[model samples]
Target: MIGAGMGAMAAAARLAVAGHRVVVYERTETYGGAVRRFERDGFGFDTGPGLLTLPAVYRDLFVKTGKEPLEDCVELVQVDPCARHVFADGTEVSLPNASRAGVVAALDKALGAGAGERWGAFLVRAREAWDRTRRPLLEEPLWPNWQVLAEKEPYPAVAHRRLLRTRQARTLSEIGSLELRDERLAALLESSALAHGLDPRTVPASAAVLPYMEHAFGTWYVHGGIRELARAVYERCVRRRVEFVFGAEVVRVLEKDGRAAGVELSDGAVAEADHVVADVDPAWLKALTDRPLDGNGDVRADPFMTRPGRFALLLALRGGCEAGAAHRTVVHAPDPESELDFLASADGDQPPPPTVTVLRPDDPALRPDDGHESVVLSAVVPSAADWDEEGMVRQYTEHLLEAAEAVIPGLRDRVLWQEVRTPDDTDDETGAFLGAVPAPALAAGRGRFLHPSNTTRLPGLYRVGGWSHPGGGLPHAGMSGALVAGLIVEGPEFRGSR
Candidate 1:
């Protein structure tokens, strides 16, 4: 395996248990890839994903790989009032975790009488999309006849008639306008996609599954930080006798008999293996081999090359977290269109204050003491932006701080110090091209949202991680590992996890 990411380590553990000697070569000094923790003084923050949704993916990993369950490895705390949404119109709603009825009631209470029912109705449809594509998109390998997935849009959109014409929502933006009539409700719907670096205006209606998945599974936080979950997985891999070589970068993939047989390290040393599983980004993987690993019909690297990355601010605040505070709060942008327009623009202009997510975990492990708190503020921005420019970073940071103030009372005065993480930082850490974060694969928009198959054209080569089948997100990446392991152990006949 090339890289010790969560997905790669997941595959390593399973492969080792299957009687295959697995070795992971990660360029970084540690594991977990983008799932990293930042520490200053005694304050710590999860710089990657703040919460875990559909944790069953990791739960299954532990159950299959060992006798111990996932709960024994790490404490999974379900966040109540899963999220607090502060909309553009000053409407606020605290959504209950995994409670359809509770969320509906909260929405009705906050956004007016019928808002909750409409949102609830949309989720019912979103669940249909989930059921239709869950197997092909998440549990199974990317089918060879993948075009079938492309041509079919699984979302059962409610139809509307206007001027003797009947129409159904095709894109997420259309779903917002046509179905979710309220602007606040639309913002709530679009924010889910936006969090994945997707443009709701153009993203397929199938993307509704994003919010549906979260609502159904509930949001969870691992104790100590999400990094603790990665640590547990790494420990499991070690227990399974999987070998890890950190700071050992694979410069090239060695081939023999037209198959990937091994990898060449940056130090010119070569390690041979029967199969090579890459956990890096597609673009980085392409650069590792001279052979055309993907054909014309395959999911190409060009489209993902410029995907948006995250800009995060880690704030060390002087005051303790407020009593009964929602763990996660989304502060919507004043002008959602301006933010979307800025993200779509290639000119790299100053972005309008973008929608920002403020995370204030109520865990004691994150802070030095009761007097100090660690807060993470993040927003989605173009990965191609000039993040290295101090002016750009400062301007964006100011915008984020301003937006966060809406949720965090006296946020400016409470901040003791702050660390900025831009796409450039993500690029340096994960080696993702331009620090781009990959969005989860969705079935629709002619399969434009789908990721490449885990099985590459190179016979002994396979892909595992967010960049491959099922695309990015904590759960999807874990599934990619499972699929890769299944394919390797059971051969081409493998039908994925049952």
Candidate 2:
């Protein structure tokens, strides 16, 4: 394995159990790729993903690789009122975790009588899309005839008639206008896509599965931090006898008999293996090999070349946790169009206060004592923006703090100190091109949202992680590892996870 990311480690553990000697070479001194923790004076925060959805992905990993279950490895707590949404129009709603009726009632109580019903109706349709594509997109390898997935849009969009003409929502923005109808409801839907660095206006209607999956599986938080989950997986890999070499970067992939046989390290040392699994980004992987990994008809590696990345603020607050505060709160932007325009623009202008997610997990492990708290604020921004400019980063941090104040009143005053993380920081850490975070693969727009196959053209080479099949997100990356292991252990005849 080329990197010790969550996906790579997951694969390492499984491959080790399958009687294959697995070795991971990570350039960083530590493991867990982007899944990292920041600490200061006993206060800690999860700088990567704050919450885990569809945790069954990890649960399955533990069950297959060992006798111990995932719950035994890490404490998983389901977050109640999964999220609190504060819309631009001052409308607020606390959505219940995995309860359709509860969510419907809350929406009705907060956004008027019929709002909840409409959102509920949308979820039913989103579930259809999920069922239609779940196997091909998440469980199975990218099919050779992948164009079938591209030509088919699995989202069952409701039809509307205007001027005696029938039309169905094709994009997420249209679904908001034609079906959702309410601006606040639309914002709620669009924010889910925006959180994943997707533009709802252009993203496929199949993207509705994003919010649906969250609502269905419920949001969960592990004890300590999400980094704890990564630590558990890393420990599991070690227990399985998988070898890890940290700070050992693979400079090039060595080929033997026209197949990927080994990797060359930056120190000019070579390690030979029967197969090579890469968990790095597409651009970085391309630089490692002279061979063409994908043919013309194959799904392109960098589908969304200019996708946005996250800008985060890790705040150490002076106050203790509030008596009744939602664990996660989304503060919507005042002008959604302006924020979207800024993201789409290539001129690198200062962005307006974008929609920000404020996470305040009430875990004792995250803080020094009862008198202090750790809060993380994140927003999606253009990955190629001038994040290197200290002034720009500072200004964006202020914008995020200002937006977070809507959810966390007196936020600035409560902050004892703050740490800022920009796309440039993500680039330095994960080596993603321009720090662009890959969005989950959606099954429309002519496969533009789909990721490349895990099996590359290079015979013994395979791809795993967010940059490969099924695309980004915690669950998807885990599934990528499972698929890669399945392909390697069972050969080309392997179907998928049962």
Candidate 3:
């Protein structure tokens, strides 16, 4: 395995179970790709994924491996009231976990009773789409022996979607108009789609399934943060005797007669393999292989990857900052046009205004014993087009920090430490292509092609993380690891090897 990211980690565990001698090479002196956490003083914060959804995916992986995903250690609270949404128009909505009625009730209180009823109707339709699609598109591997999933129900039965070519074609305007009379409510529903990183106007309507999953399934936050997931996978790797070579950068793919062999490390060491699975960035593989760039033999051009890396801010605060919260709170533009305009501003002309995402570790322990509240503030800016670690101008850095402190009073004094991480950090840390969140367009449509999955490409090589099929984020990445294991052992390979 190359690049010990999430997919690489998951693939390592699965391959070890298959009785293969697995070796993982990571450039960083750490394990767990995007899901790793950092500890400073007494504060600890998860780097990439914090909110987790799709519990079944994790449960399934543990079952496949003859271990319990949750029984041994860690417990999933199955968080309710998943998130609190604050919009530009002073509209506030709290989304409950895995329950449409609760969200509708909350919407009714915030927007109007009429708006709540409309939301209920849309929920019913979305639920139908969820039942139809989840089994086929999400659960199946991209391999050839794939079975057709989701008995396609009539579109009308699900929702009234017309004149929309792809889900990308249906913008927030259509969702606002068709789904609910309350424009604010519509924005909240579509906001989940933006989590995919495409323009709300261009994202496909078929994505209605996502909000359903979150509300019906509810999002989860792992105890002690998302890093616990990495520990679980790591523990499994240990039991299987997977060898981890951290700080070992792979220099090149050593091809033998155009068949699989192994990799050459940066320090001139070569490790051989009958089947070489690359869990690193796929672009790395494309650069190494002579394969044409237009498309791979089975893979297509990835729309999610065509976007930029996510700009992030990690803040360390005293444990008590929650009481001194700033009133400026936060605001998100309701429509994609505004969001895209904000993104384009940073494309080279000027530093994009740091769109703020607030993170408060509910765990009081995140603060240092020395009176510091450590919070990691994150925002998705136009990925730093020229995010140079060394050459970044002082003015550019000031702009993001000032923007954050402006919204948060006392942020300067409350901070024991503040660091600015551009899209570059994401690349160096997880080796994600372009180092940003994958757009929904990548995981939305037919999904036959391998985007970033462990089961695609080669037999021994498996994929994981946001780039994998079914897209990115906490729950999806963890589930992907399990899915790869299921695809492998469940096959007749178990009998053949035995």
Ranking by lDDT: 1, 2, 3
Instruction: For each candidate, give its TM-score against the true structure.
Output: 0.98, 0.98, 0.82
Positional deviation of residue 115's Cα in model 1 after best superposition, in angstroms: 0.7
lDDT of 1 by residue, 1-498 (tens): 999998899899999999999999999999999999999899999989999999999999999999999999999999998999999888899999999999999999999999999999999999999999999999999988888998888998475656455566889999989888999999999999999999999999999999999999999999999999999999999999999999999999999998999999999999999999999988889889866777775553453556899999999999898899999999999999989888877466677899999999978999999998999999999888888688889988999999898888999999899999999988888988898888899997887798988998899999999998889989999999999999999999998867
lDDT of each: 0.91, 0.91, 0.60
Q: Tell me the number of clashing residue pairs for each predicted model.
A: 0, 0, 29
Model 2 over residues 321-373: C-alpha lDDT tens digits? 87899999999999999899889884655678799999999999999999999
Which ten residues in a row are the worst by lDDT in model 2? 296-305
Q: Could you tell me the TM-score of candidate 1?
A: 0.98
**lDDT score for candidate 3 against the true structure:** 0.60
Model 3 ranges off by over 4 Å: 66-68, 143-173, 292-299, 302-305, 319-330, 334-336, 344-348, 351-355, 389-413, 439-462, 486-498
Q: Where does model 1 exceed 4 Å of error? A: 161-166, 297-300, 346-348
CA shift of 431, model 1, Å:
0.7
